[model samples]
Target: MALPTGPATSWLQRTGFPSQLFETGDNDYELYEAEDEFVLSVEMPGFEPDEMNVSWSDGVLNIVAEHEDEQRDRRETYHRRFRFPKDVAEDEITAKYTNGILEVRLPVMRGATVSGTEIEIQG
Candidate 1:
């Protein structure tokens, strides 16, 4: 079968899963930048660390989580993607899950840009 073309199609294609099986979860994220690094926090409840997957590739941070509650006959899948900042050190990205909250830290390079610089245009 042929895949649809447009924005977000790339991400969906990468999953290789049927569109019907994909459901949006209540995955809220908060990003904060400090002098040293960028901290990102995502709220994902009812999930264990082992049930989640996080990875960085091609300047994109992708997060996926799947969980099933047998008692309630409920299942959940989370898929989230973020375009990482250019100055972030992808190799140094670290994450931890605690109390259903996932915290990811992306350390900024020594000379990372915290803001845009205005360049003068010469006539």
Candidate 2:
């Protein structure tokens, strides 16, 4: 028997998933790299700032959100984690939630060395 292909892929592709989030499950997010900072955007519907948690620990960045609708008796939860890059300044991370989207900005360290320097040999 042959497995389903085109329609199934299309269904998955039409979900408005954030870039780079397909590899994970249940939630979607996007990441952007800039000259002085990295920006992360996550899609979260029906959630508030108080319901979400974000943290940097042991070189890992984690995001978790949970909410329950008492009237409808429904619950929604989201969790996603990413490993921090070598040049990321953990202490400089900031986040904001607006219009059902969460944006996190990670600023690059000002005086940190990104590469090795070369020394001239004595003549």
Candidate 3:
């Protein structure tokens, strides 16, 4: 028996199972900076838009989703958190789900910088 290339994905996405339950640790996403905002795209299929929830607090972005099939007595759950480097405009953050992809836009505040100490290299 042989496995497929690339990251392993789950097939029980519809029956209360998230995609890629075994591989990637369910944190598969594409993140990049666009102008003054950060864009994130995550692949999530077999769930309705109403089942997804997105929120931000402090410096972390949280995404939680769940689907319950009462007749079958099954449930699917997905949860992931992300932290930003620079300060983000909490009120301006927006998210959308289309074609099984979750896209989130986090606007960066004007002239926001991270407060941390610089690390020195060892010689």
Candidate 4:
């Protein structure tokens, strides 16, 4: 059996940005693919829905959020980082925050197909 070659793997290798950032931390994401839609659930804490920004572009999803210190008597800094997927639609992504967790829901287009090439066999 031969191996499958795709751009997704090539893109990851060429990017060369430590993949550790993308998979580090207790924060996790779950993707559910169904016949009708795709659901993405990301666990984001300490941020309100309004404080976060979600956008999709060029088949990539981007999420940005800032956390401000509530106490005037102390100063705090964000030392954590995250790596987002590279093939999400930023314009169609939707997010909502509740109970210290941010939930993002993205609907996959009905007829959308994964970007790749099909191999034909010759007898």
Task: Quote each prediction's TM-score.
Answer: 0.69, 0.66, 0.74, 0.55
Q: Which is the better candidate, 2 or 4, if ranked by lDDT?
A: 2
Query: RMSD in angstroms, all models?
Result: 7.4, 8.8, 6.2, 12.1
Model 3 C-alpha lDDT per residue in residues 1-123, reported as the tens digit of each score: 544435324545344543333334445788999889999998888778999899999899998888776776566577888899999999999898999899999999999887678899999
lDDT of each: 0.77, 0.73, 0.80, 0.53
Look at candidate 4 and tell me the lDDT of residue 13: 44
Pairs in steric clash, model 1: none
lDDT of 4 by residue, 1-123 (tens): 633333235455455422233324454666676554456666666666666676665555566655554453222122332233334444566667667665666666655667668789999
Which parts of model 3 are misplaced by more than 4 Å?
1-27, 70-73
lDDT: worst 10-residue window of model 3:
17-26
TM-score of 2: 0.66
For model 3, name the residue pairs that clash.
Answer: 10-20, 16-75, 16-76
For candidate 3, give the lDDT of residue 102. Answer: 95
Q: Rank the candidates by TM-score, best first.
A: 3, 1, 2, 4
Instruction: Evaluate residue 21 in candidate 2 and report its C-alpha lDDT on the 0 to 100 scale.
Output: 26
Which is the winner by lDDT between candidate 1 and candidate 3? 3
Q: TM-score for model 4?
A: 0.55
lDDT of 4 at 75: 21
Clashes of each: 0, 0, 3, 8
Highest-scoring model, TM-score? 3
- The deviation in Å at residue 26 for candidate 3 is 5.7
